[model samples]
Target chain A: MLKQVLAAGLMSALVAATAQAQTPPILKMTVIATLSGPQASLGEQVRDGFALAVEQRGGKLGGLPVEVTVMDDELKPDVAVTKIRGLLESSHQDFVVGPVFSVVMAAIFKPVTSAGVFLISPNAGLSTFAGKACSKDLFVTSYQNDQPHSVSGEFATTQGYKRAFIIAPNYQAGRDALTGFKSRYKGEVVSEDYVPLNQMDMQSEIAKIAAAKPDVVFVFLPGGLGINFVKQYRQAGLTNIPVLSTFTVDESTLPAEGDAAIGFYSGTNWAPNMDTPANKAFVAAFEKKFNYVPATYAAQSFDTAMLIDSAVKAAGLDHDRLRTALEKADFASVRGSFKFGVNHYPIQDFYLAQVAKRPDGKLQTEIRSKVLTADVDPYAAECKMQ
Target chain B: MTLLVVQALNGFQLGMLLFLIAAGLTLVFGVMNFVNLAHGVQYMLGAYLGVMFARIAGGFWSGLILASLAAGAFGLVLERLIFRHLYARSELDQVLATFGVIITLNEGVRLVWGSAPLELPMPDALSHSFQLMDGLRYPVYRVALAVTGLVVAGLLALVVNGTRAGMLIRAGASNQEMVSALGVDIGRLFRMVFGVGAMLAGFAGVLAAPLVSVEPNMGDNLLILAFVVIVIGGTGSIRGAFLAALIVGLVDTLGRSMITDFAHAVLSGPASSRVGPALASMLIYLVMAAVLAVRPAGLFPLRS
Candidate 1:
């Protein structure tokens, strides 16, 4: 009777252990985004996009219930580092998502990756992490930082422009913009100007552009800076010269920009009006839920959520298995066809998009033409991930 | 030559805006001996209120007056509730409390208006641009902005130097205890000064709304520059604030435009590319340091 009791107890314990293992533990995720100041709109889009994906899955990612913690980076690198360190110590997060600005990404990249957590960037895809510093644990759902700018460069070349005036905010991404534009444009760069990142008053810069009188102007000012620059640029009557830009004229700033941004050209990986069925569903659902037109930031973030869900579904809770599943990238992206390069950055199409007034009187980007197909980032070969 | 001409106008316009903001800040610092860091929020409130009132009043011109009045009323309310008690407190305490107010109001506006920027459409009269010179098409609204700023400065000069209230304010700035002993209601005078100062800052904001993006924390950057203006101009002198503001504005604008060429002439290509923009940003601070070193009492010290 004692032997029988022992057998029953051991069997019940084994059965309970199997049941617990099969149910899967709850997944923990931390989304660190710049959710304050002028760039807050971008972060809000990212957060909402990710939330939409999770909501569609009934608050679960890959059949496992997820508990998400969203933290604001405030667009300051130091603040981001402090918040991320506190986050790292407080909980065991399975995946870390976020950092809309490249500078914030540079700050939080190592700490999250070195702590053995997967860092999935929904927006910022800094070149520093795409090449030699690329980590097996880091995945980017967005195009490399230079790809969109390079598309503008190519577009300028195709338009038979012989002279270009380029300007960007003085920072790493700004430098990347110049390099990318120069790489494709065979035109004479009449002028290259880098303004202070927070310098809102661009009257002097506009005067300089007027003086230079380049055939085409390329600029990469983002957020509030873009809003001011575009308005001032139009007000100064310099619209006769075609302007090629990235991130400056997008859904995020179009509301304030209004008629000023109409007919302005930008380059990006995807636009709001992409013809894919998945994209259609996303744009409709995002607009329904958020009451605002979705930008590329939101699109990339939605892809990030889907990427995480697919990996988790295929690999369960195993780290190595999850990495392999993410590498496979077997999911329908809102961009239609999505795949990861060797460095885990996206190998995708780039398009030249023009800002147009939609039928509903909303300003948004409409795809003009494909600039590059199956484009691989220049830094992928330097990555040792393969 | 035309580029230079247009840029100088740009500088002057910017200077005019700075003067409007610094005019009030200097008076408060001089008369009340208060370091109200939340002065910038008054400018932000002006812009936000200007946008709202414009929507309601159905025109930018009417909206400008209503918003300025509203901002001034809000400033009076703030002074009564919080600032009145802090007049006897330490500068550090005042700073801390006002800083708290800045954060509270910034977040409050964000919650109320949402974080995206709002546009205040320029009136049809001044919406277009004119050829200031060859290759220089300047916006008419900006020119109007400068003219309005100058007119406001002139009116303020008349009131401060010409009126009975102006005499009391000057006396309070020099010797508050003596003015109180003379049976002047010093508290009421300070409140009036504070309200007028806030109104001037808001007026600057409404004028600037059409020229710049009206967003949350927009006033934060301008606030620092206003403080610099007041410090360099002499804490209480409106004339000094005007001259110093023009100097700061012209120097900042010209430095940004010409610094790259200067760097390229002096340094190698890559080095200049990096150093030029950095130096341009630092130019104003460097100017302030030099001025302070030369004249610690500022260019027009009220005490002197």
Candidate 2:
């Protein structure tokens, strides 16, 4: 009788273990960003914004635990591709986000999207994915490269800057910026200058611009190059010519340029001082956490997190269902309202802002005017989403 | 015409900065036979320290002095701890070790300052524009940079030609064994030379910080140009570095600006726009390649 009882107990324990094994551990999701490189600031902002959204959602998505994996891509396209591939393959990440440069974004698009894994681009918006090569598995929480610059051109024309000299580094993005600007502005371009991407000295270019004497200068220099150009432009006494730029004079650059950035106009999709309650709260929380004002990159990144959270909550955590829900556009963003266009780019407003001294005596950007309200990116016309 | 003059002056200023960086790199290579990739990181450290000092001292001069001193001290410590080990090792080992230092310093700066670029403000005295000619005004600060670079170059030339340490350095560059055999303390000479070389690079960084963004990886791009300058100038020759740096600065700056314009005149607007930047960037490398073809040992190779 005792031997019979022991066999029954052992069988019961085995049965319980098998049942637990059959039920897989609660679905966990991992979000990763490119956290090192020249553009680490953008990656960090996105990471912060995404984390804030997760916390606001009580640290869970779709009633299941979620995890975020922040990895450094070092801004190298190849490194980004390799690191992202490893993250997706080795770690079994439910979703992936970012590698912010368009070069890197384009590099990794094929493998990540072909595998049917969801990719949410918080900053980079490469034109190829937004048009002929649009993917069902891809969604962009950021504006296309052409959108803001197109609006900038229109705004410059409206301000009576008929003769404008355009400048950008010699790169795909640089060519795109000039193309985007020209598409909207019908005025005569006085001259277009292309400098090397890593070219730091701008004196000769500044001299040439002075010689040309254009009514205004529109530039698309990003990161360190932008800071160098703005200072050199001022040093060259070309400040008398109103300068209008895209991605050249934003929060990412404001701290570097200090008062030199003042009075220049920058066109972007989002700014920290946006007058929405969500944006206000976001800026407050982010500043408190990071001890600095968050740039548009950070705001968009935060929205990307909220975007995933909303989709995951609305449609159970099954990968396909969550992707479908994300496509439905159920989340309210800090940018007031954002909906994905047919091209997988955001249909959003673009604002013209001036770098000005705030009440706090520190240099800050203030929205001078709203250029477009719910702007549909031009690439959408080319997209064939049914 | 005045704009042309200003642009030429600007080019000269840029060349001077390049010379400051290249002079040290070439000297270390010629004498110590060290391939130190972290030299650029030291320049970056100088900029960061300058900004920090400015913040602490609340004055530009004080900050500049402190930053140069600090950078020199940091270089000494680095030599003792890291660079000393690699000096006797193979060139490949030295390259690897210095590259490691670059990575560590780049990441270290990121951790300490965060990824955001910091601003180093110009002093109140150097903030205004000075009118040199009719309808032409340039920032006083840039003019200052040019003057400062010229003065440093002059001082360097005097030291190299007239001082005991200079004799030792020149002798060490030609024959390290002979200098050591002649009762000169080779190790002490090397340490002093390394310290001075590092200080020159650091001073350039501090001077540049106000004009450029103080961010991580700021020096890497400049570092490449400095290498080009060193190669063209010939190793261990301060005068060669100065001349080569100016030539490079002028060519690069002028080529980038005018190449696109020339392209536009010859080609269609869009086509020129596409081809201009790409070609202009290749100009410097092409110059370097051409120079190398003509003189593999460089234009002014040190005479043993």
Candidate 3:
């Protein structure tokens, strides 16, 4: 009787081993996003855009079944570090995607990459990471922090604006914006002002702008600051002077900005009205599924998923093999004509977008014209990536 | 000169809004001896309520009135349910408890209103800009906001200084035990003060909503400024709060507008451009520190 019982256990073990060998290994993923607070909508776009790609793939990426865990960073760097430390100890993930804020990105990048796991930032490509600090394990699907602003700077020059007024919040990102704008525009900056970060009031600043009387105004205020600035700018009767910005008037803030953002110009990598089949489908499916227009945050996150899928298919999750495959970036991007620089940041076209009310009564940015063709971040030359 | 005048008007508008918020904060802190850190949440709730009521009523004026009433009612509910219990506790406990209230309400608004900002459209009559000079134009809505704040200030002054309740409130601030012993319903008086204070904050929120983005924690920065106002003005003294608000406002606005130019005169252009705005941010806090050094009890201390 003992011999028969042993024989049955051995047979069962053999059968289970064969079954496991026949099936693909499951991929584990963790998404760290700002899921709460004022910027939650941006994080939601990342979450939803990634989820849509996964759902379309029937819960698999590159012939492997996948399990995804989402952690809310709450837009706090300290909190994100703590959560990431816990994640590293408790569970091993193949990929960590997310963190919409640059502050949170700076916090979580080291912990995730030091653990030998790939960290993909769908948004918030801080210049700090794109330059001398570039890591093979860290990938950014979004443009470097300055690229969009640079697009506006170049566009301003093309529009024959001889003098420009620039303003941004006084922070690292704000300084980056000024540097970016200065790098491209040949025009003279009449005035540059940096207000306190999170300052809701801009009346004094607007008065200064009125007094300066520059041909164009460039601002880098995002989220609620953008809403307040745009509304007040319109109210100040400065519509005659064109306002050029990036991430200031986008799908995320357009609902609150309302008519104030109409005809306002922003620089971006992709807009919903792009004339590509994949982009059109993605936009339609996104709006249908999420009940709101997809922002560039969503588009970049979607491409991040597609990047993973392509890389996994080529190299099958082996650490070095996957790194090589990701560097290749063998996939059709929703933005069209996408490639990675030597530093693993995106090399793509930048467009000038204008906010327009769609026929369906929803406001979205439409592609006005392509401003940059296959632009690479200026910091790519500083990267020593092998 | 025109630029300076426009900036001054901006400062005045900001000052009036600060006054409305500080007025409520001073009354509660002064009369009840309660440190109510959640006072800012009342302003945020006012903005949220204004947005909601505007959507429902389809007009800015109706929304403003309804939101003010609702904010008062909500404040009374909070007072009766959570605050009154902590009134006699230590200041630290009141602070910790009210701070928790801020977190809960901030999260509650995110859950209910979602995290996106909601805007209150400018009323048509006030949407247009009025020319201040040859090239400078100011928004009519902002001018109207200052006027409304002045009117409210006038009414608040009358109620707090001239009426029977005002006398009772002054007595309560100086000595709550004596007022309670003299047969006044101190609990009822506290509740009334709390509600009225909340209503004033809400009124400020409604007025400022069109000019600013109405989102969670929108009141936080202004709350800190309001605290500074009350501290510099002398906590519990309404007149002190009014003067301090204006002083802080004009100083802050003008400082922001002219600091870079001022620095350019004294220093190199590159150094001044970088240092100017940073100095402007520190300007108000520097003023607060200066005031505290001179008068530890604040500009207008209530005799206790």
Candidate 4:
């Protein structure tokens, strides 16, 4: 009876070993974002880009299969904190991406960093994270909040605009944009306005801005608010005054502004018109898959996937090794050359572009010139990251 | 001084647009006692319809008329099929049902128009800037909007105060059961009121479309402001809605523009930069709260 019992135990051990050998190793990834509200389009674009990249890489990262799960924070910061915690503790995801808005990113900062999961930001580079609170686990592929605004301010100042009016929605990004612009712009600021985040009416404010008689207007209204501002600004006869902006005049907003956007100036970290071979390939692949041109948000998301793929390849998908490899910067991005600053935020280029009519009669934007190249963000010096 | 005048006119024009939307919301609530959250969706429908009509008809005026008519007809069908069932239900139930309608409509718009903002161009005649005074120029379309809103407001006042149908509506607001028992077809009256309310909201939307990008959730933000207007003015009075809407529009626009400068005068630049926007946004909410505290049923409540 003792011999028979020993034999059965040996057989049971062998069977368990065989089953374990057949089970594939999991590379867990989590996509956390604001899935509802006005910014849903941004989230959807990011998601599609990431999915397309994953499929192109054959659903594998560095030859190891990956499992991706997406969660919506509903644009609420408190909800984002809890959701990130749940993803780390229960889901055991090795990497977490997003919480698209800067406010939401700030909310989830501690939970995500302390948990030691790789936090990859495809968009929303909050300044605070690029400062004293920086973490090695947190990496941002997106432009720093101040990057585009700073370049835009420089361009406007160079254009001989001695006095400018600044307008933005009353939100974290809005405040940052104005601050970023003022930091670089030596010109006199005549007036500053902060409209409600979703304000649709701007007649009174437009009147006040006209009264101020600023040589140029710099506005940072994003998404639907951007569209509304551009349309109303044109109708209020503010079009003749050069309008300089960051988020207000992107491809995502150009369609809505239509002909009103023509002749306006904008600055961005990335554009579809970039002449890099990688960019051309990315645009072709994205257009073939989605049937529409990829916006800046989509490009950032796709680059994030490539970044992960490079890290995985370099480190063979082992969680600790992959994290270290990502931190060491193993990827070549479509944005030409980008390296993480000590704060894990990108040090990259920003371009000044103009909204113009294309040969096809559609209103589109063209990159006029590079405003800042390989620019290190202002907050980087404040970061004490090892 | 000319710039200030232009700004004030702009504020007044915006107020007029808000009044158009609030007027309809108040009428439906006052007469039918229904909290129709989907009223904003009706406005969105009007904008979308306007775009569609413009694409088909190839002219702005023709598109505006057809879109308004289509939106009114759509409202009638919704009243018969959905809203009529909830008149006897609780306000919460009506709110939930209307919210569902909003989601469906918002998503439906995305499916139909894609997730891009549609641009509606003004006619060539209205595109140019007209000088108001001393080199201050404003868009002609905005001036036209102000005039149109005033005319509509006048017609609304005349219909509510002078016509037989107006008397029935007043009586219905005062006592619905009495109007129903007086051998009147209350169902037809409710349907007509809903339709008219929808038409007014849609007309405002179409008029505003050329000036603003027509996008999903365009009505949602406006709807909140309109509710604030109705709550401050009183639920049933058109005059109250108009006054409150103008007040809200002016305060909101002026406060946002000047708050930073005002704060800078009292505090350091850094402090003002930090506190200005936050304080400016809180001002409107504070006004709404103060008004509510003084008059729990609103500044002017229609008898219900």
Model 2: DockQ score:
0.59
lDDT of 1 by residue, B166-248 (tens): 99989999999999999999999999999999998888889898878889889899999999898888899998899889988
Query: What shift in Å separates residue B243 of candidate 4 from its native position after superposition?
Result: 3.2
lDDT of 4 at A167: 87
After superposition, the stretches of candidate 3 with alpha carbons farther than 4 Å from their true spots are A1-18, A21-24
lDDT of each: 0.91, 0.82, 0.91, 0.82
Residue-level lDDT tens digits of model 4 in A309-347: 889878875667876788766666778877877788888
User: What's the candidate order when arranged by decreasing TM-score?
Assistant: 3, 1, 2, 4
Taking the true A–B contacts (Cα pairs closer than 8 Å), what share appears in each candidate? 0.69, 0.64, 0.70, 0.53
- lDDT by residue (tens digit), candidate 3, B28-108: 999999999999999999999999999999999999999999999999999999999999899999999999999999999
Q: Write the per-residue lDDT of candidate 3 for residues A1-386, one digit (tens) a residue.
A: 99999999999999999998897588999988998877888999999999999988999888788899999999999999999989888988899998899999999999999999999999989988899999999999999988999999999999989999998888888888887988899999988898998687888888888888899999899888899999888888787888989889999999889888898999999999988888998998898888889999999999999999999999997989999999899987889899899888999999999999999898999999999999999999999985
Estimate the TM-score of every prediction. 0.96, 0.93, 0.96, 0.91
Q: What DockQ, on C-alphas, does every prediction get?
A: 0.72, 0.59, 0.72, 0.52
* TM-score of candidate 2 against the unseen true structure: 0.93
Question: Interface RMSD for each candidate model?
Answer: 1.1, 1.7, 1.2, 2.3
In order of listing, the candidates' clash counts read 0, 1, 0, 0
Q: How do the candidates rank by DockQ, highest first?
A: 1, 3, 2, 4
Superposed by TM-score, candidate 2 places the C-alpha of residue A32 at a distance from the truth, in angstroms, of 3.4
Candidate 4 versus the native: TM-score?
0.91
Report the Cα lDDT for residue A93, model 4. Answer: 71
TM-score of candidate 1 relative to the true fold? 0.96
